[model samples]
Structure formats: structure tokens, C-alpha cells
Target: MQEFEPATDQLDEAWDAIQHVADLQDAWAAINPQGEQQRLDDQLDRNLVQDSDDEFAEMEVPELQSRQNIHQGDQPRCAIETCDPEITEEQAQHMMRQLNEKQRQVFNHVSKWCDDKARDQSVDPFQMFLTGGAGTGKSHVIKCIQYYAKKVFARMTESAEDMTVLSLAHLGTAAFNICGQTICSGLKINPKSQKEYKPLGEESLNTLRVKYRHLQLVIIDEISMVSTTQLTYIFGRLQQIKGTYTDFGNVSILAVGDFYQLPPISPPTPLCFPHDEILKDIWNPLFQIVELKEIMRQKDDAIFAQMLNRLRERKKKQPLQKTDKELLESRRVEENNLTAPPDALHLFYLNKDVDSHNERKLASLNTEMFTIKANDVDQRGGRIIQVHETPHRTTRADDTSLASYLKLAVDARVMLIANVDVSDGLCNGVPGIVKGIEFCNSQNMPIVVYVKFDSDRVGAKTRTTQFIPPHYAGCVPIKPRKESFKVRGRTFTTTREQMPLKLAWAVTVHKVQGQTTDQAVISMKGLRKSMAYVALSRVTHLEGMYLMDYDESRIFCNEDIEANVAKMPTCDLSKANPLTEIDHNTNFVIAHHNIQSLHRHIDDLKRTQK
Candidate 1:
């Protein structure tokens, strides 16, 4: 090429032409879908799906994938994903046969409703609040409904694989007791913002509809713990998911709980405390109450049962009878002498006291102390922003009770914070003794902790592990729990990997709400009267219950709750004939009846028209 000097104007024109062409290409790329896709592909190839980890981004990681799987219906919401082999048809039938007359009536009513639902009969959804005291065979009825009614639904639907029923509770421990899942987990609710529940995405809704297409019944265990606002959210969410405007999407609900126990947490009032007239209207029509009487737990001791019943509704200012005072005083034990029953569970009103007792008990044990830390990852908008090598110590964050750090010894007592297996009684709040620790080959961190559970049922199956003592037959190997929790004063969420266990020398009254212990030494110091009732009711018999301080002053139920409960209807055996009665006020006639009565009721309606 010949080197030639061009004019200044010509050179400037050529440079501008090149710049214009470059700008045109940039604009085309900005609008081109293919170009945008290519950019995404490149970003995904480098495992960097986000431009910034701190900001919101589309995630393709396994963690996010797993969460999506749950939303997509590939995973179950309740702990009863796999049916327990022990809950057989024969066993369920046998239990039903043994039910009391009142329990039998509930079973019959629910079973008939499930049958009607399966048959696609045009009827209103079944809604009932099964209320009872501490022990009125409510749990027994729940078992019967779960094991027996499921068969009816499966058989009628002609699909054994179809999910027909779900059991849910407000609290994790309560749900565990029922072999179910927490309401938030089962309903895909964001526990942090329960009152402000938003509708699920289209994809999630579609998947849930498919998953629960055959679902006819839902059993809510701790109904008392469910707040009015949360209850509304549940109803709205169900309606949205089922694509129906009807109450609870026409799904049958058997809400079982004792309102006399622990009420809903503050900021949200109890179901009885309807905030508005609209809510009150919805509440009255939504649920038909069935108050269960007859205390089954203390049936052997009728006197004690009567005493508990009397005390259940006792007013705050009411004086305890001399006999009641004498009985309670007889079980009083000095606070300093709690160690006499070395194995008895000590119940405290505060977590701090529980922690103090556990720490002191752990320190008293003569063994090597192992400080195990959790692997916590702080994430915001689907991307992990930071990793906490030594996480801040917290007893609870969100739903995960697993602490950031756990201190243990070989013989230190521990309690499960999660339900390892409910049917085997290896549920939350279960006590055990540390047998041994198995460390990972790559790190000093413990991979599994062997625990000798108090109940033989927990570790009945022999586990062939080298880490546990060869002589020990009831050792269960507990692995690290992986859960996400919201950190305080932080915008991001933290995913923690730690053992689902905590010191068990002492436990809080809140933890033992729906549980029963063989023997317990309870401290009612500084606790509300409602809390005192819950703590006292945990022991089946008065002989097994020991009070640190018998403060009868703090032993009464809420007066308003009592009045509300009194208005609730009890099951009448004479009226158990199903569909025999109809509401005269509503535009639609509501009926409660079995198959035989359905036709007769329709005939009666025809006769009345004449």
C-alpha cells in the first residue's frame, strides 16, 4: 500500500463513520433477545448467575433448586411424606373401635364427610373446631381420622398415590406430635411475614393445584395457636390455590386444640378475638364447634381429673379450695432439692433459666468438652453474600431452634430440636445422653453425634456404627440439620448447618406445651397463669408432678376465653344422625347426615316446599 497523507476533513469524516457503525452494533445488541440469551449463557457457564451477589438474581444453584422443587410439588409439605408401617388399617380400625362414644361420633362425622367429598357430592365444605381440655382423646380421634379416613379417600378416588389429607399445626413441636408439619411449612407460608401473606407465583400455584387435587381433608392440630389474621391468610391462600372463592377452597378442616393452653403470640389475637364484624361473621359460619369432655389422661385418677377440670376455668381472683391447696402442696419440692429425681425433666418458664440449668448440669459432668460450631451462610436475594465461620450464638432464629454453637460432653444430656422420626418418638424436645462423637475425616468437625435416647423406641433398630459404644444398644446417630433463618438487624437470611440438638437438663415451658412427661419438676416463677396451667398439665398424674413453688395465685385461665368456650357447642350423641338438622337462616340449606339421611333430607325439603 502506498503511504499517502489525507486531508483533515476526510480523515475526520472516516473516523465519524467508524464511530457511527460501532454505535449501531451496540444498539442492536441491546434489543436483540438472542444477544441477551448469549450473555446469560456466558454468565451461567462461569457459575456466576448474578452481576452482584448482594442484589437479587436468578439462581440455578442446588439450594434454590431444592426450594423450587418444594414449590413445584416434588416434595411433601408434611412430615407424613412416607406413611408409617405401624399405622395399618387393622390398627387404625382397632383404635377406632376403642374410641369413647363422643370420640366415635367425631370419627363418624368426619368419615362421612370425607366419603361425601370423594363422591363429588354437591355439599358445603366440612368445617369443625374439635376443642377439648388437656386430655379428652382429641389426639386419639386425630389418629383415627388420619389412618382410617385416608383409606376411604384413597379407595373412593381409586388412586392410592393421591394425597387425600394433611395434618398441620402452628408450632413445630405440636406438628411433630401429630406426625405432621407446621402450618407455615405445609402451606408454603413465609413465617417471618405471616400476617402479610402474598399469593404464590403462577408456577407455584399450578404445581400446588396438581399436588393437592385429590386432597379432601386438612387437620389443623394446635388451632388455638393460630391467630385470627393467620387464619384469614390460610383461608385466602387455600382459596387462591384451589382456584375457588369458597371458604378454605371447600376443603374440610378439623381444627383440634385446647384454647385453655397457650394462646396465640402477641401482635396477633386468638381466633376467638375477631378484630372486625366481618371476621366475626366468617368465624361463626366457618367453624362448628365440638367440645370434647372426659379427661382420658387422668381417667385412672378421677379425683385428679375433676380437680384439673375445675382449675381449667378457674378465675384469676378465685381462691383455691382447701383440698386443692392441700393436694398441690403435697407435691411441692424445694428448688434446691430438684436433683432427688435425677432423671425427672425440669420445666422452667424462661429460656434463660433453662439455659442456666443446662449449662450448670453440663459443667458438672466430668468429661472432655467439645465445642461444635455451625456452618452458616448469609444470603440475600438468592445469592450468598457472606460465610459465617464462627456464627453468633442464638438459641432461636426464625423456626430453627438450633443454636449457632453447641457445647457438649460424652455424657452430657441433650434434647432434639427437630423431629428425626416422630412415629418412633424421636421427636422434638426428646431427651437423650451423648454416647460418642464421630469427626469428619477432612476436618475436626463432628459429622455425627451418637445419642442414647431415653426411650428405647427411638433407637430400637440396631445401627452398625463404629463411633458408638459397642455395648450400647439404643444409640441413634444424629446428623447436622440444615435450615434457613433470619438474622436479627440483617436484611439477608442465613442458612445454617448444625446438629439439631440442645442441652436437655432443663427445658422451657413453651417447649413442653403439647408434650407429656412421665415425671417433671416445674418452676412457675414469674410465669403467667396460662403458662402455669400448660406446665402443670404436662404431667399425667399429680404423683408425677412436683412444683418448685406452689403459687396458686398464678393458677387460673382467661375469663374471656372461658366465656367464649362456654358458648361452643358440644357433640350430642342423639343428634349424631347426620344431616338431621338444617340452618333456617342461610339462603342455602346446610345439613349434617350420613348416606341414608341424604335422600330423606331431600324428600323432607320437597315436602316443606308444598
Candidate 2:
């Protein structure tokens, strides 16, 4: 074959196309700092060039080269500086004023450390763990710190171009609650793999430095979900990225969570596991512990709150109390069809059950179904590929939160699968009802789905690009989200773009962790004691919780975790109760175990107790 020579016009066009791709990538990075899409796009461009005529092999475009050493002006701006909006100092101080005693104490300690660091970066950074039960304001304190940090950093940098505080959480919902990112994403970690993190080369280090130039404090929420191995990975990755050998590269840390809520997922030992030498070495010394004791959510029902607390830490020998059991039994739901509220979320133990329940509920809606297929691209070993969908099945993992195909209908109850807006309570696991679907102008694909959320305030104040129906003023418009993940048994990674929603007539207990629901229909089948507590606690009031197939057997706390938590140092909360002695001097009646001894006094006791 005659040697193929590229035409000058074609070469110039190709160069222009490459330049255009680079510009698009820069814009994409501004929105998505993870940069996975950009990397995949770059690989696709290279593969196309390689398959071109042989004469063009030797001609290389500089833009197509690796961006490791690109000029500073072209480097992506720090994610925090761009993604997060500014919080005025006045707003932060106002939040500080609203904190409870223990919350204010934690804030003062951490903010003081931040003040010291702002004055002198050479000082050793502060590390602390703030532990509390559900609804004790750990998340609220985190927000305050985040707002305060932004103001401090703005003052320090003088141009608001640098970020000094980073927020992370083990769960996406918790992360969004504080306007933060998941730990795996924030640290650039692979949750499935834990290869040793070696120091980066000069060029790579330079790039990392540019991205995290002024990161000083890290606030990690849902600390109980953080495992020993993951903790080590976090330290190692931060050390490497910061180019220092110090613990977490001398970055200050505030970890907040309760061990009694939920332990780490399997295959990874929890941070509270006593036998892990690595955890003991890294956690015990690196952080001071502060426990928040006030039960703010159930402030109106102190008796119920006390009962839940007793059950949360009940040991194997300390069986459930008769009074608590009777109270829970009173709220027991006899049947889903008869007693369960139409809007109450059914919390199940298994994913199969949740899916089946959701499907059944959706079919009951009797509306025209709408199917949305995910747009996916797979990358494996320097090759770009696609897993063709068969007539029956698609190539998505069964356990992944994201589905290959989402089926929805008008009036279908759905839950958000992604964090759209945290402050507005539009994060993952929030329930909503589909009102209408807006299709693309050119195609049948859905551009936005109108969802009237259970929380009316979710989209009330938020601005939207779509036209809202005057009658459905509270409906929020949800757009499709792009997610990147690897299948369990697959070698390739799949990047999918689809709507961030799931049929939410039913959901798993694990998904409801750290979320508060107004009403919940909880299934007690096959759930452990810890899981049962997590599910039950999601409902704010006892009257709002309806248990199906209630079993007291599934109500025991982890023995090891209980012991470890007992030994944890707690802040003296003597001042936490601001009430006077009269308010705190309520008398408690101890019930007699034996009827024989109390037989004579039974009549007297009944009159006095009543």
C-alpha cells in the first residue's frame, strides 16, 4: 500500500479538535473534581489516534501528552475553592451561638486550634473524636466548623482562593449532610483495593500540591464506619499527598460518630475493635475523645429516649425491660396492608426483599411506566470497551446502589440515590413522589423529573432552570447524575450517567443509617440487634415507628464494641443540663421482681404509681 500522508487541512482540524477536548475537560473538572471522566476521555482520544494511518504515528500533539507538567494556569482549581460557596463570618458566629453546651465546647476547642494554625502553621495539629448518639448535634457542630473554617481561611488567604478545611464522611449521605465528600473520594482512595501508597514522584507531587495547597483541617463524619485498614489507608494517602512523614501529613482532624449506631462493614474491622494493633496505635494516641450526651431529637419524650438508650447498649445478660418491651409492642404493626401508612418507608433486612417490595408497590400505582437506560462506558487495561446489553439482562452489579435500568411512573414513590442538595434535606435516602417527567427536546430521554418530596423545604428556596407548575410549587426538579464504579467480578470499570433515584416504597435498614424519618415501617426479620436499633431510631417519635414481625431477640449490642465504648473517656457534662435542681430531681420507681413480696403492697403501689 502507498504510504498514507496526512493532509495539512486534516492535521489542523485534528489539532483543533484535540484543543477543544482539552477545553471541555477543563470545564468538566470544575464541576467534577474526581476527574475520572476526563481520564477516560483522554484514553479514548489516544486509542483513536493510535488506530489512524501509520504515517501519523511519529507526529505527536503536545496537548495529547500527559498533563502531569502542564503550566500552573491550566491546572484545575482546588475543588473546595470552586465547589463550595463562601460562608460569611457573621453567619458562622450565629451558628456558634445556637450550639448546645457540649457542642459549643467542641467547637471552641477545634476553632481555637484552627486559630493557632492560621497564626502559625508550624505548630502540631489538633486531633479529636466527637462521639454521640443519633441526633446529639454532631452533624450540626460539623457544619459550624465548616462555616467557621471558610471564614478563617478566607481571611488568611485574603483572596478566598485557598481552602484550609476539608470535610469527609464514610457514607455519602453523612458527607452531604455537612456539604462534604466521601472519604474514598476525598482521599482519592479505592474502597475495594488497599495497595500500599508509595510516595509520589516529583511531577505527581507537584500536581497534588496544587490541588490541596492549603488544606489544614479535615472533619470526618460517621467515624464508626471507618475501619482500621481504611484508617491506615487515609493516613498513608494523606502523608504521601502532603509530602510529609508526619501523621496524616500533620493535618488537623475532627472525627465524629457513635460506635453503637453501626459497626464497619464486613471484611474490615471497626475502629473500636480492641485487638487490632494498627488501630490501637493510630487511633488511641492520635485523637482525644468527647462524648455528647444530650438527646435533642426526643427532647419532648425523655421517657422514650431513656428507654431507647437502655436498649441501645443492653448487654447479653441485661435483657430488655418489661416496660420498654410493652411500649414497643404497642407500636407493633400487625400487617403491612392494614396498618402501614401509605407514605411510611418500609425498612427491610435484605436487598431482594426491598426490591421486591418496591416493585409490588410500583405496580399498584397503575400508571404508565417509564424506562430510563443508563449510558455506560467501560475501561479495562488501556482498552475502551462496552458490555453489550442482552435482551433480558444488563451488566450491572446486583449489590451496587446504582441500577442499570431505572423504571419509574407518575405518582411512584422514589428515594434519591444521590446527594443533590444537602442543606435542603435533598440528600441520598430522602423520599419523594414522582409528579411528572420532562423529556429532552430532541430525544425521548428524561431531562428532569418533577418530584414532590416529603420534605417541602427541600426545593422551596432552591433555584431551578425548569418551568415549575404553579399548582405543584413544592415539587423539586431532579436531573440525571453521572457515577463511576467497578462491578464486583468484572475487571473493567463502568461510568454511568442516569437519574439519581430508586423506587423507595421500601428500603434496607443499612440505607437508613444516620437519617431521620418522620414515619417508618420497620421489618424485624433477620436483622441483628445493632441493625434493629439503627432502623428503629430513624423515626423521630415512638408513635411514628411501626414494627412488623417484632422480635426482642434481635436487640443485642456488639459485646466488644460496648466494652470499648465504656472505656472511652467522656467529657464531664455536668453543665450540659442547664435545668435547675427542681427540674432534675424527678423520682424513679424501681419495680419489684417478685410478686410474692409485693403481693400485700400491690394495691398501695398501684395507687401511688398512678
Candidate 3:
């Protein structure tokens, strides 16, 4: 019998090594189960000591351990090949280099862990979390990781081929475009009705399983926008199709997005919860955690960046200096009221002049253009104002009154160069040219308009009609109402119903929640106490906030304020570690395999042609 006591230092090193080995094993099992188990068994068998020894036998243990480690570490990396033309190797390298030191390290760590597991034939880590503030290069880093994987696949393949890299955005239209693009490129399907692309369902799965049973990764961007329910659906579908061949009974998912920004909107449920709940429910155990710290966008504006960071922290406002107070007042004047007469601000205040004699009041606010003087003297103010309008008359019951008002406002200012705010079925702040207008009723009211907007594909021409209520008279049959609207010297028909009402720039705090302005006129006087904090936080500097009859105490003392502060996630990056060599190798292998599969398919086509 041998009595062996491992030194404390040696024990610590051994434990670290074992933990690393275990991580690798877990990743390997995810990719290649049979191979992983066999390798583990072989290592155990080789490491088992049968000889009985004296007091010096402990010295032999370290040598035996080293042999076992070496034997278990020599397996080939797992490879995944892609066949999509969207991503290139040079592009991937460029993206990877963009990552900050901390992010790069974390990526490398995950890659190594995945690679080690592949070598050991064990389950591979399939999920990862990349957390950071705005401008932290989180999105950029994830894109690089995706590109790197694709590039590695291309490089390792025998025949040069591209890999499938689907990059989905978090919002509307973008989501559809991403999925459509993937289907178009990967499945060779057209979206047009006559040439509609139909997924082959089980057949497609079978083909993929036969050709790419060793597929390595599926990277999903904007993961924060995806609900757990949606994720479960995606995973469930993958599990059903890939079945046993799935790396972890599904594809290795790399989801990247900021959790703080707008979260998933569907189902109207909260996206983020307490850390404990997140860890237990939303956080996948296989996910390797990585937090990026460097602020890339606002690096030059440190003070502005700090203000944003503080805003995220939900810090209370301190007393402001005189200059700050002045700045705040200026901002309030700019953001809260309509720049022109009959502004939304006037509507808010219900000014008698603006409400009773709208036509006369709006006519006097003529458009003027002037530049600031070079001499220190201030020229007439050159501030831009936003106006919102809603039509008073309804042409149809279903017609959106807001749309008619927006069209009328835009038409009124077609030549004046004023920014018009139209709260249509589009994302806020989406700007487009007002191309043409058409009258819908006998009164020559403009109901439908044509808009040409730029999209990923090309400039799309879309015709949107304002929801008209039934009471409004249809276009008068006796005579066509003639109105002049011009864009680039092209005259278009306009309607008499179009009123030149000034729009007050007003958006719910939630809509403008994450944005910061140099100055803001926040109107929280009548709003619920819960919403006051949101309105106040919209400004960057304390001086930027213009309080319009706001209850300072209500905003500062609201229960929601406390809740928001308590709910804010702590963003500490001091404890993060760098990625290991094994991670890089694993990522390389997965990329290689994916590219190889695609190349093989291309080669088969060539052979058939010959």
C-alpha cells in the first residue's frame, strides 16, 4: 500500500487543470458523444495505478497524471463548413481584430473550451452571454466571432467554399429580411408568390443530417430581443430535426445583444428579471459568460458617456449650477413646445389663440432660414422644431386620424424644410421622402400617399393610405380639387383637407427612453409619478432638462424610481478572464468542418457535370 500526499501548490494546479479538462469534456460531449465517452474511458484506464509502493510512490503520481492528460488532449478538432457567399475570410479577421482586449479574451476562452471538448469527444458548450453597455463593441465582437467561424470553415475545406452565416437584427422588417436572406441564399428559394420557396421540412433535415452531421455553430445576434419562449421554440425545432446528431441535442447557439436596450416586445412581458431568476430560468447552463467593458463609440465624449452610464445606474440628480439651470431651460424650450405657432406644446397648454383660430395662428409662423454669426454675437436662434398633427375630420371609421394629420403637415412644409413627425405604423424616427399625394374623397382630401424609402434590397415604392372614417364625404364628383406638392421639381396632387397645423414634438418617455439630448423640455406635470423618472432621465446633463411645471418631488420620490434603480444590472468587468488556446483551436475545427461540408456538396455537383 502507498501513502501519497499531494503538495498544496500541486493540488491547486491539478484542480485547475482538471476543471479546464472538465470544461473541454463537456463541450466535446455536446459535439461527439460516442467519441467523447470512449476517450474518457481510455484516459481513465491508462491513468489507473495498479502497483503497490512505499512512501516515495506519491512522486510517481504526477508523472502518471501528465501521461493521462497528454493522451486525452491529442484528438483532432471538430470542424464545421459553411457554403454562404455573404461572409469572407478577410472580413472575419478584420472583425475579430475589432474586439476589445477583454472581449477577445472571452471569445478565445469559449473557443478553446469548445475545441478541447471536441478533442475529448465530449459535450461542447453551446450557449454564451456577451453583456455590455451601448457603444461597448458587443455587437461588433459577436459579428467578428461569426465571421471567424465562417472563415475557419472556408480555410480548412479541401475546396474553397463559403459557409452559412445568418445575422439577424432585433427589430421588425430586419428580422424578416434576415430570415429571408438566409432562405434565399442557403435554400435557393425565392420569396415571390409564384416562385415561393417551400422548406422541405423533414427531407431538408435529413439531407442536412446526412451532409452536415458535425455542424458546429449557429450564431444569433440580438439575443436580448428574443424571448425565452421563442428560444425554446427554436431549440425545440432544432432538436426535433437534428435529433441525436445535434451537438447538444441542438445547434451550438451564440446569442449576442444588450439586455438593457429594448427587449423582446411580443407577448408584452418583461424581458429581464432578477439575476437569481435569470440564472435559474433564462440563463442556459451551457452558456459561457463574457462581458465587454470598453466603450467604443463615446470614447471621445467621456463626460457624455459617463452621464449615460450614470443614467443607466439610476443615480439621483444633485443640485445644478446656474449655467446648468440655464442650459436646462433652453432645452425645455426646444423640446417641449412646437417651434411654430399652434405647436403641440400649445395644445398641451390649450392656449386660446392656438386652439380657437388655428388657421390664422399657423399662417403667421412663416418659414425663415438664417445662420449663426461668426462674430461672438448670437444670431436669431437656429433651432429645429418637430410638429405633430391629427386630422379633425374622419373619412372612414377605420381610418387613422393621426395619419391624415401627418400627411397634411408634411404637405404643408414640403417647401419649408421643417422636420415633420408622423406616428404611423413605422418605427419612430424613420425618415423618408414625401414623394406624391393623392386625393381620396369628393372634397379633394388627400387619403393615400406614395413613399419611396431605401431598404437593404433597393429603394421600395410603397403606397400607404390614411385610415379614413365613414362620415367624411367621398371625393366630390363635380370637380377635382387641385393642390400643389413638389419634391425635386416634381409637382404632385395634394388635398384641401391638409391643414398646416404645427406639430408639437412629443414622444412617450419609453419611446425616447435610452436617448440623450443636449437639451430636453420634459413635460411631466400631469403624468403619473411612475412615468416622471423616465421623462427626466431623457436629458444627458441636468442643465439639459427643461421641467415644464414638473413636480420635482414626485419625479425624485416616485416608487418606480426606486424600483428602476433596484432593477438596474450591476455592470462590473473586473473579474473577467481571457480565452485560452484550446478555445481558438476548437472554433477553428468547427469552422473547418462546416466549410468542408459545403465544399463537398460543390464537388459532387462538379463530378456530376463531368
- Alpha-carbon local distance difference test for all models: 0.65, 0.64, 0.37
Q: Poorest 10 consecutive residues of model 2 by lDDT?
A: 60-69
Model 2 alpha-carbon drift over 4 Å, by segment: 1-94, 198-208, 266-268, 275-280, 335-338, 371-401, 418-430, 438-500, 566-610
- Candidate 3: residue 171 lDDT (0-100): 29
Q: For model 2, name the residue pairs that clash.
A: none
RMSD vs true structure, all candidates:
12.6, 15.5, 28.0
Q: What would the TM-score be for candidate 3 when compared with the true structure?
A: 0.44
For model 3, the stretches where C-alpha displacement exceeds 4 angstroms are: 1-98, 110-123, 155-163, 173-215, 245-248, 266-288, 315-430, 437-610
Ranking by TM-score: 1, 2, 3
- What's the candidate order when arranged by decreasing lDDT? 1, 2, 3
Model 2 per-residue lDDT tens digits across residues 168-270: 8775556655667666556554454333443334444465577677888888887887777667777876788787899988888888888887666533355
lDDT of 3 by residue, 368-472 (tens): 211111101111112212121332232222111112333222212111111121111122122122233445543234444333222212111112234323432
Which candidate do you rate higher for TM-score, 1 or 2? 1
Highest TM-score model number = 1
Q: Write the per-residue lDDT of candidate 1 for residues 1-610, one digit (tens) a residue.
A: 1356657678757855764455443455579856644543333233211111011111110000000011222221111112243576556656776677677778778776666666765656778889888878788889888986677777755567677788887654466567676665566654443444456655556767777887778899878777665677678768887888888988888899888887765333457654563333345556778878889978887877888887888899999888887888778787325343554677776667777877887888888888888888987546677887688564332435566778988888776766455445555555667878778773446888888765445545435424456665568888887766676655456888888787767766655666665577888787675777777777778887888866888788877887665565554433444433555555764455656756534643443331
Candidate 1, RMSD to the unseen true structure? 12.6
